[model samples]
Target chain A: MEQHMSEIVTAAFIVIGDEILSGRTKDKNIGHIADILTSVGVDLKEVRIVSDDEDAIIDAVNALRARYTYVFTSGGIGPTHDDITADSISKAFDLPCEHDVAAIELLRDYYKGRDIEFNEARQRMARMPKGATHIANPISIAPGFRIGNVHVMAGVPSIFRAMLDNVLPTLETGAKLISTTTPCPFGEGIISTPLGQIQKDNPEAIIGSYPKLAESGNFMTDIVVRARSEEVLERTTGAVRALVARLLTEQDTGQ
Target chain B: MEQHMSEIVTAAFIVIGDEILSGRTKDKNIGHIADILTSVGVDLKEVRIVSDDEDAIIDAVNALRARYTYVFTSGGIGPTHDDITADSISKAFDLPCEHDVAAIELLRDYYKGRDIEFNEARQRMARMPKGATHIANPISIAPGFRIGNVHVMAGVPSIFRAMLDNVLPTLETGAKLISTTTPCPFGEGIISTPLGQIQKDNPEAIIGSYPKLAESGNFMTDIVVRARSEEVLERTTGAVRALVARLLTEQDTGQ
Candidate 1:
């Protein structure tokens, strides 16, 4: 690919639920969202997991919406009394949340011949903030909503993934980042100094060193280099690989 | 157990690393910390994952430290150039970050006659904010630090766990929340209305409904009830169980 650098597209994720905070449910959405966004050239800059409290939801939604290009929230949109996400999003944007006719019709059609009743409780899924468009859920008929720059989806992993598939295509994406990882059988203490110098020499690339404990009780390090430009990423990755090779040669020669 | 309503101890977790945000590293710390805190009577109120930027780290640290009883941070306290968490923590607390004599001595002793060099980059681990106490890291000799209410630990899972083990004994705990989960072989649409009523009748208990898509393509739900009092928790869980049984009977009779 030719060297191309574009304006960065950033997004923030907000997870609203008491179950997650209480450790009753382990979150499966954050990593999935992060991976999808990165593949589509969107940088997930920040993520916040707040409780079901309305004030906490409002604060996180408002703070992230203003700071990033887009904001995505999951959970608290179900039919239970504890699900206050719609109202909180409405309050955060100063928009009134009311029942959307399209969503109501969709849910009614889905439950038409089924044993389930499209009761007032289930109709709660039809509610959305004003000036919002539906993000269709293929697995479940209840639709998620997109208001302003915020996309709200379900908490269930299958529904969340389906809704994200619907919402991603509508977002603005940037130049995808290119990265390479060089693994060394040494600790960060051995390579940290030269790694810092390599980072300075290659100013266009972002280099990170992560230390991992091996299964054999030895410490190993992985040096990752990332950049939007393929040329810079390659050059920086080469420098890291060369540094590791030099360190290995020194050890072999008893330096 | 005796019925008790003690104060609640709350905590917030902040993860500082671009690796986590970029999806290069799936976070293993949030769930582990959540389970540990809940078991120890400390409610994990919020969680934030931000990049390695200094301003971002400082903002998250300052905001979480002010609001929660304790703030636990993982990642970015290494020797590399991008590892600026220690400096950011100092800026957040407005304290001078200097090399601690004790930490330096400990590291020096650990690296004595080893293949690793106790150079400037490795010595960076000895720096801590003024008035901070060291949290011993048994996996690696480099100690994490606690400044005020924020505990800074390593990004590595083993080191983070070790540091948390060292720090947990010193913190204050509260009345543990008692919880029980009841499984229902039905979708939320069938139980939302009665669940809302049960939640209102048992106002002291916090009830949550999590719907899962089963392997056979049927929707199943788990109703969880939590409370600080054993009597309240058991009573509320019983109400939920009764509600589910009634719904199942109605379905059996074609109501």
Candidate 2:
């Protein structure tokens, strides 16, 4: 494993849509982006799902962009009246939004031969914040944009993925987080005490126990150990393995 | 269908777990809770997903609780070292968490002769912040709690649903939102111009367009108009239905 990093690059996702809040649409973009960010060594610290309301978008974009190293937004950049993310983003940064020539050119080329006309609505996709750089969208001709730390993209999963592929390579990478998972066919109650001790001993690593209810009405916990440092990761994972093993052995001999 | 004169209630959800951030688990609670909240007249304003980190939970809780009328938290109320949401939430309110006699009694009665022992770890579920009232859990004997406007519930979907059923009846209900979704065969680009005009004409209603790209590589947009007042909802939906009819007629005649 590589040596632990000096700083862990963190990111926040602002999912912009009204369909999501209305529960009409199940969000497919968050987990997709989270997987991409994790594989590229960026810690996705927070995610917020907000409606298409302009004030809500402005508030969330400003808050997340200021806090995390990168702020990735999904949805609301399409060519519709309700698609107001780009304008709201401009409001967040207190800048004017205008039609960009590069984006307009891409749209014109894509729509020249297509059924969807390059009308004012499709032209709306070319509107981006002033002084913002475009994030390429191969899936859709309409380009996403990057202003400051925020990367604004389309709501559709394919377009969001394409934009991410374009933006990920340009950002700085951090030390990758390493993890090990062990299934504990035991109740969380049985391991809480010793698990707390393990947590105390390995402060650098994050230990999490997730409890799932079984068919027979028992708690099944999966313990995961995560750390940026290899030594810490191994040591903590070793300790967790030993503890679960000991408990298993004890139950085998007695119960 | 009632007059929209009163205030609109809002809620923000904090989903606590490492599984979500790791992309190992697809979240089921957000949509479930969003649906429930919307049904009960409360607007689900935002949702944040955070890991089991203490500072992250604390910060999210504080921010959401302050911004929205209610803050609902799911996860981390189990019997393990990683189940630290109860403690973290207590810290958010600057209160000490202790096992409530009511919860302990309920658990004790339920587990008196059960296979899983009612041990110290199980006792951990009884812990709640000072001056908090317990929210009953029907699936499990353990209960969730409410401190101020923050409602702390289980991470498990079944348990979370049960707790929500108990909590919903106690909350103040607002005017239910009315919605009508119009399936527009025309592309979003084709309708974007007039849709903006319709949006302006119906400022009381929220107009949303969700475009679905088909296997045939065509854009299908579902436009939803939502409002609290029945009159406004009807008027806005009528305008949308008329506009879509006009567009469809134009396409049929190739005008």
Candidate 3:
């Protein structure tokens, strides 16, 4: 596959559940997803946490899938009433959902050795949108689905993470990453103006400053610069270094 | 201040940075903040990740502060050029940016014995939104701000965590949490329908299903029920147990 040069593969995460919005569950999926996507060079642009409402899910799914190269949704796929993600997605794409034979066979094989009964409720897991492919869940027989560019996975952190790992290797990835950082004993404001100038100078590189609160109630800031190309990252980092040096000198001069 | 009986406190998180959007840095702020707020009974309804663009910051700040009982922002408050959160917040609130005497004095006191220069760059940390109070950064002299209901804090995990500890005690919290869980050897689909029925029957109790992926590639789902009152939580949990038992029995009979 010939990859496009300007192809900045972007993805958005939609976390659905009332528990997360209600503050009953602190989400672990975002961090895990973000890290996994980063390692593979896919930029995670936005994350939205919405409730279990069907309209909300449909709206979010539509918006995100339109805006980004891919959309990944976690939660709301179960045998329960609230697990309406599959129905919502089917509605969004105008596709009919029926139990898939391949998925059901996999589920059957999974339960063959165990004493567990594969009931009607359990069979619901085999349902998938027409033309959708299964993202194998090595941990569970109930597979996640990939419909078009959207990957729908379980909400539980462990399962979502496992499903993600299973899915990532199949996707096309572009560049490797290069990053540099410099720590300063100053707050953010002192360097904001200059950093903005550097950013303008090197639009190819991404620059960020993180202000930290020290144990003694003082601020320490770290300026990080990153790029896909190593040479560009080095050049940008050199500029950052000079800027930091000048800022330190200005601090010494009391200006 | 008269607190309304049915009052619900809500919060929104503003994560400002290009780093997170570019996927170079995985954010730790949102998860920590969500956990802290949930523990204190505050609902975290929305989270927005915006770039260091001044207009973006100002817009998000205005919109979030208006909708939520409290708005907390992490990142973009440092001594560097990209750190524009304070100035942006000040502009959003239509407040003047000026060096706060108390904050400056604190910074001076903090750097007294250290070899660090309290120069123009460091002094920038003292600038606060006019009429706003400071949230003490016990870890750093550059204090975060609280203008109206918005709380601005550091982005570093350690510092943000510390500052949150200080700020949390001052906020009013409602209703202690009561929760119980039961483990089931089924995938989410099997339990979804019954879980929905259970939730419909017990509207006040919040029921959630978390599917765990085992090392052997099987699913273990834990159904958790939560409520503000212990009696309600207990009742909901009993219903959940009965539902799970009935479902399992039905599955056995079908097999």
Candidate 4:
């Protein structure tokens, strides 16, 4: 429940991977995080997909962290050569990257009795920026780190979800948006003028019109009205429905 | 064929729609475009998803277009009230959006004998930023347009694909990358130090070590070396193979 002017909590997502850009792998993380954030009332304002370059990661982290209330970065935290996100983040914030004792201990316990030796490469997963907190990954022992407003998570869909489960409880959320939809039988061209007027009238609401190309060779539009309060939502949607009816009547009468 | 030091052509994608942010519609266009661009030797450097708001879209278009060799925007070219991409793109470049005579004629021919009238809203698709050229869409009569280096396409995946097919041939491409991979029995962390040295030795080649979690719970790494020329790729990858063998032999001998 929120008032007319609830403060909005904005977030930005940075998807870091070369596999995505090279078309080797299609990303399955962005939509999952967005759906979760939307349900929790945080506005997913912007999203950026950048490759596994240290300078590129650092630049995006600095810029997005400064711009949004929360910055969520997925990927580039593995034990590989391209896993330079932690070091880049450390450079961006001018912090020292150190091996986290707790993370190292966790990895040791997980890998205990494994045939492969716990070599230097496996140990790289424990290194994080100094003064940062860990985001737990149940699927894999490679814990993601958070410094300031930036939350780092794994690129793998399963591990990222687990880390998010450990992180979502800590952040502050804004008012959840309530929405109403009015379907229009007429084409979008027939409804645009009235919809525009309704949008102008409701300055507090966000209006979006989605068109559907039906298989029956008919086109339809679904106008969605979203607002913080149910009262505003109903008022805007009511106006839209009425305007559509009026326009249809006039078109029928040849006026 | 390019030598070791070929110029890389970079591109940025801007997805303009609120549907993506709200998590109502999952975007299917980014990966499609990225795969095509990569095969043609253009680096898909960055991708940004912004809402249909004018200021947000304009800011992103200007920033991405200025930074990358080319920018492709998808969505907000329909007849609905919230379809504001054309106007925003015009404002981004400080140009006027007008109803292009050619586009209007195309629309008229397309909608001829159709059940719905070609009203103002449908005709709005013909309105693009001044000096913009059309990108043909065979699926739908509404055409995407281009201004300077920014190419605007439809949000629907099928129509967007049709428009991209028409646009890709006209753009210039860089040298197609040549790559080779060397598999390592050890983890990524074990090889990162040596890989970093290899990367330093071959500045023109990009060395990326990707780790895979084996079924036996041990992690193995695959080192991929990318360069503009086959000789550089093979040379870097050869060094990586020798380094892995030496490391393995030393560990087996308990050195």
Could you give the interface RMSD of each candidate, to one decimal? 2.7, 3.1, 4.2, 4.3
Write the candidate numbers in order of decreasing TM-score: 1, 2, 4, 3
**lDDT (tens digit, per residue) of candidate 2 on A1-255:** 232377788899999887888788889988888888788788888899988889989888888888889899999888888888889999999999999989999898888756445778888899999999999887667899999999998888888888889898788878988889989877677888899899999999988887778887767778889898899999999999999999988753110
Per-residue C-alpha lDDT of model 4 across residues B1-255, encoded as one tens digit per residue: 232236678899999998898887899999999899887888899999998889899989998899998999999998877899999999999999999999999988777746457778789989998899999988667899999999999998878999999998878888887677778787665677778888899998988876666666555777778888888888888899899989888753210
Greater lDDT among 2 and 4 belongs to: 2
**DockQ class, candidate 1:** medium
Task: Give the C-alpha miss distance for residue A162 in model 4, angstroms.
Answer: 0.7
RMSD (Å) per prediction: 2.6, 2.8, 4.3, 3.9
Question: What are the models' TM-scores?
Answer: 0.96, 0.94, 0.81, 0.89
| Model 3 chain B: lowest-lDDT 10 consecutive positions | B1-10
Error of model 2, residue B24, in angstroms: 1.9
Q: Which docking band does candidate 4 fall into? A: acceptable
User: Chain A TM-score of each model, in the order shown?
Assistant: 0.96, 0.95, 0.93, 0.92
Report the number of the highest-DockQ candidate: 1
- DockQ of prediction 1: 0.60
Off by over 4 Å in 2: A1-5, A252-255, B1-5, B115-117, B252-255
> What stretches of model 4 exceed 4 Å from their correct place?
A1-5, A113-116, A181-186, A216-218, A239-255, B1-5, B180-201, B211-223, B236-255
Model 1, span B1-255: residue lDDT tens? 121248788899999999988898999999999999888889999999999899999999989999999999999888888889999999999999999999999998887745556888889999999889999998778999999999999999999999999888888888998799999887777778899899999899999899888876667889999998899998999999998888787763111
TM-score comparison, 2 vs 3, better candidate = 2
* Per-residue C-alpha lDDT of model 3 across residues B1-255, encoded as one tens digit per residue: 223235677788888887776555678777778777777777777787777889878977897798778898888766666667889999999889888899899888776656555767667778879988888887665798888999998777777888888788767665645578888776665677678788999999878887666665555677888788788998999998997788777764222
- What lDDT would each prediction earn against the true structure? 0.88, 0.85, 0.78, 0.84
Q: Point out the higher-scoring one by DockQ: 1 or 2.
A: 1
Looking at model 1, the pairs that clash are none
Best by TM-score: 1
Which of the predicted structures, 1 or 2, would earn the higher lDDT when compared with the native? Answer: 1
